[model samples]
Target: MVVFNAPFDITLINAELRRHDLGSLEERLGAETAPVIDPLVLDHSLDRYRRGKRTLSAMTSVYGVTLQEDAHTAQVDVSMMLGVLQEMAVRYPRIAGVDDGALHQFQVEEHRKWADNFGSWLASKGRVDDISRAWPQE
Candidate 1:
C-alpha cells in the first residue's frame, strides 16, 4: 500500500475495522505491514534538513508535480502523492534502490527518531504532548 501518511491512514482503518469487529489490515494481509510506502515519511527522512511545510501540497510543489485537481479529495490526493513519490525516487536514488521491506523498516526507525526528537523539543518548551513513535499502524 502506498499512502502519504501511512500511520494516520492505517490507524484510522484499523480503528474502523475494530469498531466493526473485523481484523486489522495487517491481520488481513497475513503478515506484518511490510512493503507499505509512505511518501511523507520517506521525504521527511530523506530530506531532513529541508525547510518549510511538509504537507502534500507543499511536497508536490517541491517535487515539481502539478496538481491537476483540487487537493484533499481522496482521488486527487492519491494521484498527487504518486506523482510526488515518482519525483522523490528520481531525485533520491537511495529510495529506489532499497527494497520495499527494507524501506518500511527504515521508515519505522526514522519515525521513532522524529517522534522522540519532537517530543523532547515539546518537553523543553514545557508542553506535555506525547508524540507516538509508532509507524504505519499506530
Candidate 2:
C-alpha cells in the first residue's frame, strides 16, 4: 500500500474496523504490515534539512508534481502523492533501490529518530508535547 501518511490513515482504518468488530488490516493480511510506502515519511527522512511544511501540497510543489485544484479529494490526493513518490525515487536512488521490507523498517526507525529529536526540540522551547514514535500504525 502506498499512502502519504500511512500511520494516520492505517490507524484510522484499524480504529473503524475495530468499532465494527472487523479485523485490522494487519490481521486480515495475516502478517505484519509490509511493503507499505509512505511518501510523507520518506520525504521527511530523506530530506531532513528541507525547510517549510511537509504537507501533501507542499510536497507536490517540492517535487514539481501538478496537484489538481481539487486535491483534497481522495483520488486526486492519492495521484499527487504517487507523483511525489515517483519524483522522490528519481531524486533519491536509495528510495527506489531498497526492498519493500527494508524500506518499511527504515521508515519505522527513521520515524522514531524524528520523534525523539522533535520531542527534544519541543522541550527545549518549553513545550510539553508528546510526539509519537509509532510508524505505519499509530
Candidate 3:
C-alpha cells in the first residue's frame, strides 16, 4: 500500500483519486478513522512546502471527499489502487491499454495532468527532488 502524500487543493486530489478510480476519499460520510486526507502539508502556515498536502487536498475536493481533519492519513488498498489505475487507462485514449507509454503516439508531459508526473518530470530534469518540491506557492 503506497501512502500517497499529495499537496493541497481539492481538484487535484480528486483527479488523482479519479485517475485511479478511488471512490470518495472517505467511504463513510462522517467517519473519523477513514483514511482520506492525504498525509501532506495542508494549511500553508502548517507546511511551507505545501507539496503532498496540497496535492492530496486537491484530489479530495475534485471527488467531493471529506475526511476528518484530525485524521490526516489514509491507507490505500492495493486492489483498489489497481482499479483506479485501470480506470485511468480509459480516461485518455492516447494512453489506453499502454502502461509504460510505449504504445502512445505522443508524449504525456503536462504538469497539470497529475501532480506526481509533474514532479517526476521535474526530477528527471533535475529541477526538483520529488513531488514535495513541486508544491505551488500561496
Candidate 4:
C-alpha cells in the first residue's frame, strides 16, 4: 500500500478502529500489515537538495502534479502523493529500481538518523532528553 506518511496514518487508523471496536485492516487481512510505500520518505531521499516546505501541496507543486481537488482529504492526498512518486521515479530511476526489502531497510535507517539528530538537537535545547528510535511503527 501507498501512503504519504505511513506511521501517522496507520497510528490514527488503528486508534479509530480500537475506539469503534472494529478490527484493524491488519486483523481483517490476517497479516501484520502490508508493505507500505511512503512517498514522503521517498521524496526526501530523492531530492535532498530542495529547500522550503515538504508538505504534500508543496511536493505536488514541485513535481508538477495536479490534484483533482484540494488536499487534506485522504483521497486527494494519496492521489497527489502517488503522482509525486511517479514523477520522482521518472526523474530518479534508481529509486524505483530498488527492491522493496532494500527500500524498506533504507527508509528505516534514514528515519532513525533523522530521529536521532532531532533528539540530539532537542536535548541541546532542553526540549527532550530522549526520543523513541522507532520507525514505520512504534
Which has the better TM-score: candidate 2, or candidate 4? 2
Please count the clashing residue pairs in each candidate, in the order shown. 0, 0, 27, 0
Candidate 2 RMSD to the real structure: 1.2
lDDT of 3 by residue, 1-138 (tens): 123333344346556766788744444244322222222321222233434535444544422445335433334333333333344344435445543333211221222335565567788888964454332211
Q: TM-score winner between 3 and 4, please give it.
A: 4
- CA RMSD per model (angstroms): 1.4, 1.2, 15.3, 2.1
Clashes of 2: 0
Worst 10 residues of 2 by lDDT: 129-138
**lDDT (CA) for every model shown?**
0.88, 0.89, 0.38, 0.76
lDDT of 4 by residue, 1-138 (tens): 777777777778878887899878688678866467777777766776679888888888888899556688877877788899899888888878988777777777766776787689898897965655565672
How do all the candidates rank in terms of lDDT, highest first?
2, 1, 4, 3
Per-model TM against the reference: 0.92, 0.93, 0.25, 0.84
Worst 10-residue lDDT window, candidate 3: 103-112
Q: Highest lDDT, which number?
A: 2
Clashing pairs in 1: none
Q: In angstroms, how far off is 82's CA in candidate 3?
A: 1.4
List candidate 1 segments past 4 Å from native: none
Q: Name the runs in model 3 displaced over 4 angstroms.
A: 1-76, 99-108, 112-138
| lDDT of each residue in 1-138, candidate 2, tens digit only | 887788888999899988899889888888877778899888889999999999999899999999789989999998999899999999999779998889988999988888899999999999985888888773
TM-score, model 1 to reference: 0.92
